[model samples]
Target: WQAKKLCPELVLVPPRHDRYAEISRQVNALYMQYTDLVEPASIDESYLDVTGSLPHFGLSAHALGDQVRRRVREEIGITISVGISFCKAFAKMGSDLKKPDATTEITRENYRDILWPLPVGALLYAGKRTCEQLRMQGIHTVGDLARTDRQALAALLGRGGDALWLAANGLEDAPVVPPDEQPAVKSVGNGRTFPRDLVTYDEVRRALITLSDEVATRLREAHMMCRAVQVSIKDPKLKVIVRQMQVGRPTWQRREISDTALKVMAANWREGAPIRALTVTAENLIPADQATEQISLFDAVPQKQREKQEKLERAVLQLRKKYGADSILLGPGDEEH
Candidate 1:
């Protein structure tokens, strides 16, 4: 809000994702007035499948889209832009082109002309890191990439580079997969690249613990559990090592995840070498109810320790949630000096 005052053009507000989601549901409902086949991409974006309903709506797809946007502004107190397209990916891309809080459209014919010459950053899946790499290679525009050979790009940027090629050609095999089949909760992971190289095992372990707590809190927030865990590290020179482990049962239990993560860190870490980064990932997630558990003998901790850890974890979560993420103090930097 303060930033908006400094520059009037700056659209600023404390992001209330929950509030936006509520408004999104209402906007999606308005869209359903035009067609039932609506795919919500995010709180601020949705793709409407208006294939057969245009006839009864008494409006062309564009006209129906205009009405939907107007309805959201008039009825919900928030403005929305709609993009009518044959597929989800294009619909999103079309919406992005008009985004300063407005709506636009792109038919199959206009897609190539409209998207081809635009900067590579304009493409849907073009990531910040990828765009910088392209800029470094002197390929600033999508057209330059589209004209490049696939094999050469793959060699330069691996599979990600090839994906850029496909997107630049306006060629992608992705489907408008329904949200349910898309898996509501897919992954829980955290990675941090320290600004310096770290040489101490204890220091690296502290960073891993912090990341583990974050990953576990995220999983619990989504009411999900993981059956697999993985750990990765990068040396000062950027050499990478990774390890994956399967749990006997799925668990959202932060303690279990932390224990396994620490074990991996202990096993895979270079004994006394400087390292620059640490990453931990949990995959094969399922709802908490579906997770399995096991009886423990030597693995069990003392009740006093468990209670103390639980209190600390809950306090940290409360403080972090109320304040920004960096509000809490944790371990020293794990990067190589």
Candidate 2:
């Protein structure tokens, strides 16, 4: 309502996440009919690596793209634009050149003429803010960005600018990830915005316990362990403060994650400060099977005890999986209010 007062033309539509996901799956299935190497970029976009299928289909890239567009229009009753190129970046760039039902091809011989004249902001990852910065530096076009020195761009916009310059020049060769493959897990995190502001240590501790339990569960599910824990505290005024600390041992245990998150929170946040939200993130992830703990000489818990605790946790996890998530509770205050 407040936004409409400022912008009278604003139109709002309720999000249909489930329906969009189903549509995406159906579209990806159509891509798989042509090639198994389909990478879904988002709900509305995807990249297809049809190098091997090209010979079998007896069609050029542009023809294959046309076939895909026709198939989608006829079967799905939705029109799709496509771009055909040797690389994912340029292919994506080509796709954006046209609208609802068009196919644009960017071959090695013609890409320079087709891509270089576009504004620098048209490049992937170069948003409005980045374009403004680049324009201030006299980089107004994609050609200008490509010709700029990589080191100079890095100095101006950090590594992202240098990477963008490389991309503009068609120097990037990142492979399109296949649909069935899982990319390496970087971090697992969970956060919540409280209904009421919390200003007590007990409230904060309870919140951290709940968050850590979720994070630890996700880590275990991914077969990964975290070597560091980070806590983000957002005050009632929307100011945010983050603190992180490396753990003594890499762990996926709920107790360890909770304790570490609490330690960082205590170190960085005022004891009774009003907090609107908090997030606990497990970082520096490694495969659980490959994780080796450095046993301290003065360690309190023995290896046998630690092993037993992990076994018990795994058992509880299985019970929850078989019965229901609410079938088991860790402690007295574990139930969500």
Candidate 3:
């Protein structure tokens, strides 16, 4: 994130889910070699039950946690933070405190010394509003909550207050369970800003054409199609005007995405709007096989244009495969601003 922030001219691309899943398969396979009680919590985090594996690993739990951190960084080009505890709640809390290639440990004996000193909002399920409420009643910190009257808190906050009291004491009732099913991808989109604010319709139209084309090309490459197209116009004033559409099916056709975007641009935008950024988003995706067809019998788009797009998609994929990503982008991909 900092790398992208420092180089503001560089396009900040979304993390590719396909590439992540491929890496996850390898990491989980390695985890199973250590313990079968591991559960993936999110794309970047997991929970492991290593109670029975201490003998095999020939190390204490803290040592094992260190090994796991090393394994993640060595196997994947990413860093991970971990927390180990006797129970799920505190273990998660420990991990939350540890970040960016680090690990932490907590147990019942030292729970108050560690957890109590932290802010109340640092508890796993606590929210900002709850902390503010607690502070309003002179409970400014986790230590303050531990010293507060539970009966009065429960009376004031009702069930919510009771839950907070228990959590603050690390005495929750629920257990850590595993996720049940596969996770699916959500939205896919691309955005670019002009070298300067583009004022003419022709300039805006050209920029929209390039962005829409890039998005449509990638959607088809994923073997996915979109059900909706959204256009965003970001201006010098930092105000944004967005126009949305719900199309019936996914389309690889540039005309389909482009035409919809033109309507959005014309309807939602002002005639002389000074623009700082433009983004094109395609959402509610489906498999290519299930995507709805939009081309009509009467609308005969040019044959050469279709050939060019297909060739461009293939070329980009092939380059990304053989060389590396960003080795080549569509030449003159940007519109004159």
Query: TM-score of the candidate numbered 1?
Result: 0.68
Between candidates 1 and 2, name the one with more favorable lDDT.
2
Q: Please write out the lDDT profile of model 3 over residues 62-120, one tens digit for every residue.
A: 99889988987987767777888887767888998868878888888898999888887
- The TM-scores, one per candidate, come to 0.68, 0.65, 0.56
Flag regions of model 3 displaced more than 4 Å.
1-29, 35-61, 72-80, 85-93, 96-101, 106-180, 189-222, 232-242, 247-249, 252-263, 271-280, 292-296, 302-304, 330-337
Task: Estimate the overall C-alpha local distance difference test score of candidate 2.
Answer: 0.87
> Which 10 consecutive residues of model 1 have the lowest summed lDDT?
328-337
Displacement of residue 280 (Cα, Å) in model 1 is 3.4
Model 1 lDDT per residue over 226-251, tens place: 98889888887778998978866676
RMSD per candidate (Å) reads 6.4, 6.6, 7.5
Best by TM-score: 1
- Model 1 lDDT, full chain set: 0.74
| lDDT (Cα atoms) of all candidates against the true structure | 0.74, 0.87, 0.75
Look at candidate 3 and tell me the lDDT of residue 291.
55
